[model samples]
Target: MKEYIERVTDGEDLSLSEARTASSLVFEAATEAQIGALLSALRAKGETEAEIAGFAQGMRDAARTIDPDRRPLVDTCGTGGDGHDTINVSTTSAFVVAGAGVPVAKHGNYSVSSSS
Candidate 1:
């Protein structure tokens, strides 16, 4: 993890596996300061698509998911948060999907102001 941190601090991107490890560490039962350092360091180095995907994959794996045997298994997921330009397309799409007799499982979150 420290090596990954060093790579990122040196403006080098982490490999997919390293990113995955770093992502897991963020959610570990550790101190907030430790988490903050990880986040802050990553933020300072700017984000990479591979890193972001690895992080999201880690978080998704940790999340509670529905059983695969559930009926009406339709997904209309969204990334959420359109800043001040949200047009509710995702919400509208959910309604449309449900109206078509498909069980729409929409997942999203409130808009957050992330630092650049």
Candidate 2:
């Protein structure tokens, strides 16, 4: 949909030419029907560990331009899907560590199902 494309591309700081290239790539790769089917299948099956690992590796590669040496950094992330009803213990731990003068990068999604 046009609205979906607009929302995805708006204010992304990309050049016009770059945006056009990306749009072309998306359009050429998958039709709306194909996209819908792929999404449905992925949602039903869930992502495999290899798929997740590839995604994470891609993210790390994309961050190569960033200088990690600028700060003494540490990341605190928890595996396992906590239902978000546990009072955000990990977030609290991040704050405590930060308060104790350790730089922490905490990554978490909002809730398992939005209302949880």
Top model number, lDDT: 1
Across residues 1-116, which tens digit of lDDT does each residue of candidate 2 receive? 34324433342233344334434444456477654644344345554454345435534444425335758666776532565545556667888888989777877566553232
The TM-scores of all predictions, comma-separated, are 0.55, 0.36
Candidate 1 overall Cα lDDT vs. reference?
0.73
Off by over 4 Å in 1: 71-107, 110-116
lDDT string, candidate 1, 1-116, tens digits: 56666778788987777788777777775467767766778899998989898888878767767665768767665544556555657777888888888776777675453211
Instruction: Write down the TM-score for model 2.
Output: 0.36
For model 2, name the residue pairs that clash.
none
lDDT of each: 0.73, 0.51
> Where does candidate 2 stray beyond 4 Å?
1-72, 113-116
Model 1 TM-score (2 dp): 0.55
